[model samples]
Target chain A: MALPLVIDIAIGQLRRRKRQSIVSIMGVALGVGFFIAVASLMQGFQQYFVSQVIDIAPHIVIKDEFRTPAVQPAVAAFAEGAVAVRGVKPRDEIRGIRDARGKLAALEAVPGLAAAPTLRGPVILRYGARDHSVALVGVEPERERRVTNIEKDMIAGRLEDLRATANGVILGIGAADRLGAGVGDIITAVSPRGVAVTMKVVGLFSTGLTALDQGEGYALLKTVQILQQRPNVVNSIRIRLADITQAEPLARVIEARFGYRTESWEETNSNILSLFIIQNAIMYSVTGAILLVAAFGIYNIISTVVHEKTRDIAILKSLGFTEGDIARIFSVQGFVVGAIGAALGCLLGWALIEMLAAIRFDFNNPVLRGQRGFIMSRSALPFIFAGGFALVSASAASILPARRAARLNPVDIVRGAA
Target chain B: MSAPPLLEARGVTRILPGEGFGAPPVRLVEDIDLTVGAGEFVAITGPSGSGKSSLLYLLGLLDRPSAGAVLIDGEDTGALSAPALARLRLARLGFVFQFHFLLPEFTTLENVMIPMRRLGRHPQDEIRERARAILASLGLQDAERKLPEQLSGGMRQRVAVARALANDPEIVLADEPTGNLDTRNAATVFDVFARIVGEHGRSVIVVTHDLDLAARAGRRVHLVDGRIVSDGPHSPVVPQAVA
Candidate 1:
């Protein structure tokens, strides 16, 4: 019977001081909102880091480190022995060769590959009197198109025509624009060794990558080989696999044979990934400080309640309320305040997160300038955080006040003796 | 045979611990034999500093006697624990003081319901209805919702009486309950005592200076210098000797 009365009194008291209650709830809401949003952002960053591994490149890349890529066709020898190295071997690596004869044979060994080697190099070209230096890659048109989507990036002519001539080449649109040339135009190119070669532009490309489009050219490897005079040498052995997921173990096997270093896409940007984790940790710690502030506010409210209700407790004793009962009443009051504040805080915090999510605060993190800000997750519950904070804060805040209420003496209370 | 007295004191005495830098302990009150029967009203009066209030307090179980026995309902209170004494007080006794300490924040109804609710003898509705009826008997039926500050001194004292009787205590103690009232209000308050005792068959012990009010009691005992100098049946008497 008295418990309801006590709860009613608690509600009335809280209602009377609406401003204080709101302020306390706001403090808790801030903590909860910050905590949840930070957590969501951290999760988003983690997902981005992992997903970027597969999105940006192959699952695995194999290359000889501390040495420039060899200019030879070693892929056939490597692929034949690839099965002995402890994992599934898909398509074989292919050297930068012109004919595609040896590379196509390796591709046929693993029937899954619909493609073969992609050629790549650096060349200086001149067109219509003004020219610029750019990276030049040559490949078998049909096979290279199956491996990478170079045809979709064509700005002019057709990818099939890139293999039509020994002197045919393709240029990225930016590279063409820099050289003031287009399809069917002739260009003079030279390697770093000043070995001059003339090529006819059969197609132009634009991959939307500034470095690649502004500096890359494409040609048939046979023409590139004829022009570079390198019969059996290449920069790298680009392998075509059935699935990228199998590439890592396959690359490890291939690397073991050739004694080359292997890399996965995740290894490309390790520093940025680590920065996301560190930033998340710092954010959570700061949010914890905000929760501490909310706890302090709860303490203040309970302390005021203890002061205001002391004499009423004295009269309660005269009426035969036990010390324990009095303590219970006060503790109940503290809990009620905490519960209400927590509930309100949860609402406010949730609303705040929703609003922030709508705005999407799309900016880089201060510590990770490349990272996008503000990620929303259904699993990030601001309310739960607020609720846990409220319970702990209320219990802690009520302890001293409850003890004081219990210690009151009836004789002294009625007479003003204590 | 008649039942034993509700309260009996055999040479009850009280001593205060030394104060003012360890002065010697002083006997606050000393008593001989005394008995209060179940439905008997007894008033204790004294000059200031004569320890009449102190004796009343010790008898009311608010404090322990320095030496001697106070048997309440045939059990020695000294043999009981402090909490047990409190329980006994709650169950059997009520107090009205010179100042109306009727819990200022509570309404007249809430204040009167306190003891009955504390006792937990009845359901909530039963307690509330009984408190209302008791307040009505005290002529505070319409004032049940009014706070202490809203009621006059006389009305507040009457409310206190209703509250005291709410639990049906065997004895009601008042230390100048009408002390703050005017002559007319004081007469009205004292007038409630006879009517209540007659109808309810409850005991009352009052301490007061108004001889007119004192004369109305069934029995009056006087204390001077911490000793009973005169006691009679509501009749004026010359001092037989110094207390």
Candidate 2:
């Protein structure tokens, strides 16, 4: 038969059995939906995880295989060489929260370089007998504005207030609210080394970001360095590069020259990243099982169709339909069903995603890293899942039925009661 | 014209092995020689269990004859590959069954269009025109678009007749085309067959238990216990019918 006529015949056959055709399509759609759901969730987890890793470290990081002070001298040398390389890191460090003055000044001013040291630590604060521990950071008033968005989070006080007071601290609005401290309230902090200091809450900030807005305090870097008893030494050197994603290579260059251990942003949170990968693998595998079951359902429906049409097959054969044509007719039916199911499933998956996003579903499953809840699926995984599931189910559904149709004894079916 | 008959067979034996282990082989249709010629309408008659259907199947290439040779247009069927055999069947053979074996899912038009599609050529309008013409010839012009399920028994059998002629086959092999019809319906099916063989110049071999229908053919071949008992010109009414 002409190929298009074969398709027409196949499609007409399906139209005749409208209910059966619809059920088969639904079977494929369910299979695809399950697959897409798993794929979307897996993809969301990956994005959340990869970003977290990037949040803490650079796009790439290279550390000394060993993490010990035994290589301290080589570490310094590695740091110096990394600084010597051109286009290595950004010429400025915007550690806006706090500044580590005397400790970071000399290293940052090294010619052909851009670096800054900011005070980053936690402090204990007491308000009317209620004491809570919160993170405290000190930044250079002028240079801090370049890198970070801390200044944009001014709740009530001004940046001039931070520059004017000798003992001034900027508090995250959440932290200040919990402490019941206004912009002019006084707070006390004790350094890790047993040194105590008191500072006025001259400025309040709110970034509207969860991590930065709660339990955080900022002060002048020089004042922080003095209080912490690290006059010329900073806790961590923050590096920005011409290409942020090139941190691993940059860290490698620095580590190679200075012999110091370095870590990229990705490596900083490797555990959660591994967790995301593992979850995706598991979820897709589960979806595969669902697809298998759905395919099985489709197979069952098609098998019935083949059995019911035995007499029709005999007539077609007797009328000169080659075995290939018979098989193709049925296969065409399956392909149409699968394609339709996949298309519908795609729409359904998108609708479900929108519905989920609307509800702000929290995927706070402890197994997921960072307790993150809402994530949007933004990859080809959804289409792949739906299309893959439909294709596999559709083709699989046709196999046995098509074979049966091909193998039928035309004489027997035609002569015998069908 | 100088070659073998349009259909020629020699010692056509078919032995089917019983399924899986130890069951003895069953002789389904054995040592049968049958022939029909151009422009001839022959009828094969037998009691049930006489392998009348099996013999027709062997001739039609619906199933392979287990042993022996059957030639169509002088081409030995045994030597052709399965696909080649299928092609041979498509190119030359047509079939009608006791039941109206029209595809219930398709309309009478599509049923007629099937064999034409197997031709795999000709435009849509041409195919449709031919199918409509065939259905019209069968006096089923208005019902061509009606599904087989919607057709009456007589109409359905007429549709089957049209389908058998769709490819313009040299021979139409029917296994009891009228076994399920009433007397009138059976006579109507026979009437359609007579016109097809007479006007179209194509041969037809119908298997029937109905004596009236058998008597109407150009010749009659009788089978009993897997053997041909009588082969003759159409009738018990003709004294030389068994000669």
Candidate 3:
């Protein structure tokens, strides 16, 4: 039989049960719509969180610590346990990267990478009668700006003031608030090694992370090295890359070359990323269940149609329609419903997303201070996925009924009718 | 002997399997041999449960015989595949049932066009024109656009006849085509069947309980207990061919 005739009969049958067909179509449409809406909402927040992490954190961090402790010369030389070495005394060494300048130069020469050195140590800031402990990081102002977002986070004095003014420091807004200090305030900073210095605060910045904002401060490398009594020593090298996804591979290369431990941002935030996976699984499974339920509606209506039109089926069979043609006729009804439902679903999903985007939350929480409304993704992937899923499910639901209709023996029906 | 019969059944038998395990099967029809020639109108008369419709179904290729073979135009149909049989039916045969089972959703015209469209032998416009002509020949030209429910019983049966002739098949098999109609409507339906054989030179096999209707056919076959009891002209002489 010609395909157009089959489609014509399929459409005619659907029109006969107009109300049931519309209901089944609406079920499919709602399933796809909610799938798109929920997917967009979840993915939008996830992308936002990822972007924030990428912007505020170094893509790769090369620490002063080695990946493995040094082995004794005897242990290396002796042939496979022939000589057992025990309790070897270790030599004292400085706790910092030994050829920081050479390593930084090598990293900076690579394309699309920025490297900066920092000396980080603990210190106590005393202003008036109050004292707060903070991690004092020593950095070169020009290189640090390229590797971090400190310049953009500055609320008061500029980062370059650390080079212009002698003994200037940049304090985190939370740290400064606890110390009751502001820019240009002269404060005493006492290092763990008992060395003390009077520092002038030049800038205040907030990074939105509670730990960093409350317990970190930045100053020039010279001043911090002197205060920590570890002159000419840099403890860490932070790297920023043009493509942040390259962090893991580049970190491995740097670690292998330098014999130091390296960490990528993905590894550092693996817990949260894994949580996103669970969130996505839950989202898809829930939406899939809804689509499956909608598919049952298609199944119910088609089965009822087959039962009600037994005589018509018998007549069609006797008129020379093959079993395959009968199957195609019924399957085409499902295809038509699925196609129309998917199209309407995409539009409904877009409308739902827009409605969600318009809803504003009135809350005083600092974490949500800048967000005006719900985060929603506008990418086309969710719409396509939901529509495609709905179409497949709806078509699958029709196969059983179509097969049953096709297998009906016309002889029995016609004789029974007589 | 002028030409091989249009349809021939050789000792055909059909058994319906029993419902439970180890139960004996029941025979719907057994050892029935029949032949229908082109341009001959034959009526099958039988009492209830005598398998008149079963014989017609076997002749129409709607049911497979268990013990014997049915042939169409001297071609044995037992070896053909299901799809091949359906194609043969599409090209060479048509059927009407006791009930006017016109697709309720389609108009009279579209109902008639179904078989021609299924055959796909002609362009759509030609099929439409041919379907209109057939309906007009059956006195249903004014009822072309009306749905089956809108028409009277006789009109619907006539529409069914028009649909049966859509592909211009060599044979039209109708099972109790006018069983539910009044005397006038039954006469109209029988007249349409007579015209199909006489005017178009097509064979028609009808199953009916009414012997008066059977008496009008060129040949009559009577069945009892799934076996033919008589096979001859209903009158003392066979009806002469029309034109």
Lowest-sum lDDT 10-residue window in model 3 chain A: A363-372
Candidate 1 regions exceeding 4 Å error are: A1-5, A8-286, A360-373, B1-4, B8-34, B49-57, B62-70, B77-86, B102-106, B209-211, B221-243
Sorted on TM-score, best first, the list reads 3, 2, 1
B1-243 in candidate 2: lDDT tens per residue?
Answer: 586789977789888898789988878777888766788898887777677788888888887888888988777888887678777777788888878777676788988887777775667679889889888887899997798889888888888888888777899888888767789988888988888789989888888777777989989887777888778984343232321
Q: Which of the numbered candidates is closest to the native, going by highest TM-score? A: 3
Clashing pairs in 1: A71-A233, A71-A234, A72-A233, A72-A234
DockQ of 2: 0.52
**Compared with the true structure, what per-residue lDDT tens digits does model 3 show for residues B95-115?**
888898999999999999998
Residue A311 in model 3: shift from native, Å?
A: 1.8
lDDT, candidate 1, at B202: 77
- Candidate 2 lDDT by residue in tens digits, A56-149: 3224332223355343444567875644334444435432322334323643554333344565666787766767667777666665554344
RMSD of 2: 7.4
- Tens digits of per-residue lDDT for model 1 on A1-418? 3645555445555666778767765766566666666666566556655554444233444443523444334554576554343454545654433344554465447645444454456788987679699877766777666656667667787878876665888887788888888888889998875778888988887665566678888787766665566655554444546666666676566556555465544455567667876886787678778777777776677677666666666655554556666777667656765676676666665676577667634564433324444555556354576577766777677778778877866555555531
B1-243 in candidate 1: lDDT tens per residue?
766678887888888888888699877777746687766677777776677777777777776788998888778899987667767777888877666667665689988887777687888899899999988877889999998899988898888888877788888877777778899888877777776667778787777766668778888878777777777785464434322
What docking class should model 3 receive? medium
Least accurate stretch of 10 residues (summed lDDT) in model 2 chain A? A56-65
lDDT of 3 by residue, A1-418 (tens): 2448999999999999899999999999998999899999999888887877787778898898987887778878874777777887767678999899999999999999999999999999999999999999999989998998988878899999999888999999999999999998999999999999999999999877667878999999999999999999999999999988799999999899998999999988999999999999999999989889989988898899889989999999999999999988888888888888888888989999999989988874444436777789899999889899888888898899999999999988987887
